[model samples]
Target: MSKANLSDNKMSATCSLSEELMALLPQTKESFKLDFSEKVEKSVVILLHQARELFYEGKMNECLKTSETIRDYSWEKLNTGTWRDVDKEWRRVYSYGCLLKVLCMCFKTDDIGEAIRVCDMGLLMGASILEDILVKVVNVLQKHLQHGKRPETKIEELSKKKTKSDHTLAPAVKLGTAVPILQCPSLEFFRKNYLVPQKPVILEGIANHWPCMKKWSVDYIQEIAGCRTVPVEVGSKYTDEEWSQRLMTVNEFISKYIMNKNDIGYLAQHQLFDQIPELKQDICIPDYCCLGSGEEDDITINAWFGPAGTISPLHQDPQQNFLAQVLGRKYIQLYSPEESESLYPHETQLLHNTSQVDVENPNLIKFPKFTEASYQSCILNPGQILFIPVKYWHYVRALDISFSVSFWWS
Candidate 1:
């Protein structure tokens, strides 16, 4: 059905809870034993329920006003309590208000991006309950969006245009050279030279002491992780239409991808350490993580295992990272946050953290600005750790069957 018709059907649904919502307002006002603050809380609950009824009754403006009132009340009255206490009631109500307001904005103003931003904020605030509802709203907006205006579609079009123009007009341009390599730099030296400057660097001796360097081979990994089911990336790169994810046993992954190079199957970004304690014993977190908030346990360790030629497209992570190459080699390219615009980061919410430009092969015609973006590259070899600062764009391609561990902290 059309969006308009779907909306109309939703509007036609009976709002039977209207009377119950109205009844709560008077009960809240007349409760003599209740404290003023308790009364206000009850009133807010009633108001939110009333707003939901109004929304079902097609009173979009009234629903929006009620939602805003709840938000304002929560902001002014509930900001003083401890987070553990406040999040139980006030935060949930506040998130509900935000969700309703965004839904109204989507329906009334047709500002899908604004709606999405509000949803992002809600999720960050821990409103996981609204995830399904938010997804449905985004799907509705995507379906109704004008042709060629959707972010992913627009990016695909730009990629095609660049490909066509590459043959006729602009010549290819190189991005930049390799990242500087340091041997066993001290924690202070690393913090001062690389972390502080937000520069990418390769450290040679950091992972030499790690037991994984000697213990983790294809045979050992297959024996330990064989039966465990894992989420694997099934494509060469995420930018392709055929790209997808699959779940399979580690044994199957090893046999299909590692033993024989049939396709680019990768165990990318899986928290293998958390899932397998035996594997965790093989590696240790680098000492430089102490430079952060000192919450050593808060560090997230992920495993990247894949066959030769598997590609991880240009993407950025939100935390400082130590990528330790335990087995085989990988070619990595990195760009600083300052060069984001030049790289043409994906405008779509889904791929917002990824770059549109293919780092290995640039289509200079459509993304000519990418030529101006300076980048650092490196070939991460066994027992080497590459420090990638937060929000730095990095791309990776495995030169051979590889197993790497990454620690994200900060």
Candidate 2:
């Protein structure tokens, strides 16, 4: 009879539909063995089912508590090993717990903004559980919610001012040889000359066609994904002991890290294109990746966004990488596979791919041979793509507020 009552009925229907969808999710296969210990696996299964049952029975508070228990247990299991070592089943269980928890919260408190925030937290912090049901929930809830107010313009203005006045150039490195630049070479020529020979080359004019070349900017991204949660890397580099990751809204990241410039925070090496598909529409996968397995799924796309001075330590990757500079400038120094002996790669298995020596301010006393290592350096600008062959040791530092997309293919 009234608009408020009509809105309430719609929300009720949405929640009911969500619950039905959750019920329809396939149960875990009993035949498949989980990688966790038998005790952990048993707890995970029992707790997950209990959380779901409690939620279905309409015991929202109890359901929330049970879901939290499952989340904490699974998280402890996750922390016991490296990210790669963690079992996918444990991640799945953890994500399901998050889903149940968020739903219970929504059922108890009819706060659309808080509901969206919780869903975002699960999407960023949790794993792909139930075919990414959290994203679906976000889409459904977004229809009922209005967009938040724009961020303060002072930060925007300050960033533009800094970009213009802060002309601090990249420190002149000793390695003077610049990477060879090529204008839109044919796919056949690229494959034959650089890809086959495993040589590094910077290509121009190819990425000019991408919409991001013109449409993407700090203000634009903030306007689009300001409220969405994302994982931000804190500190100068991953090698630093103080380095750590935090999950926050993209707006918060921009306010505290990018615009404020309080500390170095890089949103590096994340599949942001997958998280925010709207941004992915702006760029296309390079044809050069077809030189590898030719499967679209084989290519790994990662987004790197950070302010000036964020450094990627000298490291080698197992697959060929094409680092495309979409915004701002970056100073990149690369070493061929032949120079591995001089690079002084870390001894530990975890850090073996990363070099121990700091390429920028090298300690020649400890790494005497680093000086003899031949390196090709470049000031990669917007719209340029740097093709790095497999195992090419590269050290990257953002010369300004930078955003780069990297495609890694075998």
Among all candidates shown, the one with the greatest lDDT:
2
The deviation in Å at residue 327 for candidate 2 is 0.9
The lowest-lDDT stretch of 10 consecutive residues in candidate 1 is 164-173
Candidate 1 — which pairs collide?
A: none
lDDT of 2 by residue, 92-210 (tens): 77777777877787666656666777777666556776567777776655554545444656456877767653344875645458889999999999999999999999999989999
lDDT, model 1: 0.70
- Whole-model lDDT values for every prediction: 0.70, 0.80
RMSD in Å for model 2: 4.4
Q: What TM-score, computed on C-alpha atoms, does each candidate reach? A: 0.58, 0.84
Question: Model 1, range 77-115, lDDT digits (tens) per residue?
Answer: 455665555544565666667767866665566444455
Q: What is the Cα-based lDDT of residue 398 in candidate 2?
A: 90
Q: Candidate 2: deviation at residue 382, Å?
A: 0.9
